[model samples]
Target: MAASRNLPIGFEASVAGGIPILRVIHESTAGDRLRAVHGILNGTANYILTQMESRAIEFDQALQEAQAAGYAEADPSLDIDGFDARDKLCILARMAFGGRLKVSDIPTYGIRQVRAIDIHSAHRLDSTIRLVGSAEQTEAGLEVSVRPWLVGCRSMLAKVEGVNNAVFLLGDKIGMQMFYGRGAGGDATGAAVVSDLIEIARDLAAGQLSAKKVSGFLDSHDVGICPKPRPVSWYLRLTVKDQRGIVARVAEVIAHRDINIDSLEQEPHLPKERLSFVITVEPVSEPIIQRAVGAINAFEFMLEPVLLLRVE
Candidate 1:
């Protein structure tokens, strides 16, 4: 309705707080075709992961501290469970790809399963974990998801610690650009609100309301899902009852699926009743790896479900 009436509508604060990421995609990169838009969209979740990494604490302890520090809500399911990021990703995907995207359609995975042992294992491999939301235009379609990725120490995602956000934009003409700042705080959100108002006032003084012509915001076209996503490395952590031939059995399952094991390690000097096994597999599509994971999980020695993570 507002667009039809040539009314100026501002929503700069709706996405990443105070970063002006929407404006960058809407105005600054208008000439270029956006190939991808991805980043850490949730400050609360980022804070929790960084806290666990720095303090060497469990997810529960980190949640308590985040609540005490006023970084999280009493009902933090939206943030910690990855739905908050999912909603934001849908908006960004629509803008970047110029199509209507349903928030529920995108796949989402949270950091709730992350444990202290996972963090310890990540440190040993010189990597850390971050909840990332990504959307990219592919030959098949738009590939999108919100999940925890095992990022190396030197990567930009790992550098964004605490209650901060970072957004990366890829374009054919502009190449790659990054936007980083405080994602959600009273000050940051307020600043964004004021900036939007200032723009509206300027438009009013000009005697013309700005009509938003963004394709994704106005178009009703549906974005197609990528049928087969490109292959990537993966990390699988399994806790199981100690017994003979466990490794052989797990290897057989992976081999049966035609997936190669990149590296496998068992934590030293653990209890005989329970042990931690970390497996790194070579690049393979999600479906094939999942099949192998299902086979391994069905074994009698498996104590719990496998924790699978994407390796960056």
Candidate 2:
């Protein structure tokens, strides 16, 4: 891979103890130069989140349904904990931005903490949630992360539901293009493998079998992921052991951070002992929100950690 990047070689060969090997050239600029790549990489996570939004189910229930449908395994730690998507994002970022990256380099957040109330809140805001793996070339460097984001109802990302996958690639020339299809199941994976095999077979038949060296993978430059703190709306949910001045106390923290609250809502018909408070805040940096959340969670009235979601 290193030799291919430095040499004038259109093809390069590799061997594993006399066994023939093949590699796909993924960085083809046959059309437009890519600016960004974003996708729903994990089908199991997507399916679970889809159920939570479409059926108004809780995370555990959606996960169980996904397992029953074979979309998830009995031990779905990688997908549910965001590692699977993190791995995928690493590869995608390398291909898209041509930089060295590791799974641990990117910030990742999973859907394990997502609740029915979060989904319901999303609906009220005319939006839904999806696990998005994205890599974009920005001034700060390659901005990459794998996490759940609140996508507007009319957005293309929100249109992807259930086990289906959609990859959106933005290019300087082509603008924005999306590739959508089934994301999981053996049949889908097998089809992709078979397609590559058939292409290789055709090349061999035509006496054109040769190693096609791909770029980007060999770049050893460290991808400097500077945190680009852009102001954006946020959704925060706090489960509390209901007590007096809960809202006032939380609001004080927000005020201390210099963040403005857009709205505050409480889920009605819930027991006073355990209640959920939903807050929407005006555009604020993630650091500001984190500080406020940290202070709020330190309160004794808190029953669970706060859930935070970015409003797209």
Candidate 3:
């Protein structure tokens, strides 16, 4: 209706709070083609992950702290489970890539399973964990997902902490640009809302209250998913009951798939009945690793399903 009537719609507060990211992608990049857009889109999830990294706390403890601090809701499934980020990613990807994206189509994984032990392991590897939403154009199609990534300590993504959010835009003319600020809060969101209102009012005064055609959002064509995502390093955390052949059995599954194990370390002092094994594997696609994980999960000694994190 708005489009038909040339009525302007304001939605800047819906995504990254006060960052004005939607405007930047919708207007500022008009002259350039965006190659990719990715970042830490959820402040609640980021707060939890940063707390886990800085205080060395478990996911539950960090989550409780976030809730107490008012950064997360009592039921934080939307934020912590990657769905919140997924919706936001859909908006950004459509704006940047010019396509119709189903919010449910994007694969999402949360930080609920992340543990203090995982944080400890990340530090050993000089890295930290972050929930990242990424959408990039590829020859096959658009490759997009929202998941926890094991980012290096020195990487820019790892530097975004607390309730802060950061977005990176890659374009042919702009190269790479980053927008950083408080992600979600009354102050940030209110400011964004006001800015949108001000812009709408100005346009009304100028007698130019016309709907801007955002290609991706307006286009009826569906975005395509990549057929085969490129291979990358992976981290697999397995909890198992310590048995005589546990290591060998797990190794055989990986070996059978022709995937190379980069490194394997078992946390010391864990009870024999419940042990945590961290395995880093060489670059491999998702399907291959899932196949290996499935075989390993079926073993009788396994206590829990494998927790997989992509090593960035």
Candidate 4:
């Protein structure tokens, strides 16, 4: 209650489990002109990667180990799948960008599907996998997406290691600033919550709280979601039951779609019952490849949906 905490401005904690952090300070606006915001907010992926590094285990196995250790949950989809990252991003975006936004409105893609092969590919190019939520000013609106990306080695953003959260801000004078540290764990986020509360109390005492203090998140233009997202290479993993004409059928599908296969590899020693085929495709829009995948999934002999990844 405002009486107990002397809260007239407000106090609302969210999906973050920081034992009620005062993560709200965006209400202050008497001077700030413009701001940029983002968050690296998921804990599961961070924890999984840390486990992978420590145990020298594959990502999937590391995630499983994290789940068993209670560092992850029964259904860690929220964390691993990218929703958790989006929620935290929503809060940060509202505070930093001064915009109104609902968590659901933000597009999200999880790292749950990232296999060791994908991570390996990222590193081969001197990159590292990171879950990033980005917002950039544009002619239409703010462009944003929560997805796994291969951050270039040259990017300081790439320097962020496992379980560490980092945020970048760019503005008139602020130029470029990064808030990097414990993205998770009770200590880091909990400290953030407490700090928020302190600022809220200070602002309320100074009569700086105003309901009209606006944010552009929801109000900002949708920024047209980068439709027809620029052509990018892709990684496709196909599982087959070792039936006849499997490879030929696949090639035909790719050809019909006007997509070029850059390289193809079949892991040696794969059992006849379950063979893994990896396909690297030249740069192309996603829909083109999705059609090909759709047709491939229709085959009864197809093991499951062919896994697809947008290559960096």
Q: Point to the candidate with the largest lDDT.
A: 3
Sliding window of 10 residues with minimal summed lDDT for model 2? 16-25
Error of 2 at 167 (Å): 1.2
Better of 2 and 4 by lDDT: 2
lDDT of each: 0.79, 0.72, 0.80, 0.62
- Which residue runs does candidate 2 get wrong by more than 4 Å? 1-33, 192-214
Report RMSD (Å) for each prediction in the order shown: 5.9, 7.3, 5.7, 7.3
Residues 117-171, model 1: lDDT tens digits: 8888899989999999999898889889998999999999999898887888899
Ranked candidates (lDDT, high to low): 3, 1, 2, 4
Better of 2 and 3 by lDDT: 3
Residue-by-residue lDDT tens digits, candidate 2, 231-301: 77888999998878999999988988889999899999889998999998999867788888889889999
What TM-score should be assigned to candidate 1? 0.86
Better of 2 and 3 by TM-score: 3
lDDT of 3 by residue, 1-312 (tens): 434422225543443335556667776446788889998888889998988888887888888888888878889998899987787777778778876888789989988888888999989999999999999888889989999999999999999988877788898899999877766643455443223323433443465743243434666688998867778899999999898989998999999999999999999989999999999999988889989999999999988888899888
How far is 200's C-alpha from truth in model 1 (Å)?
A: 17
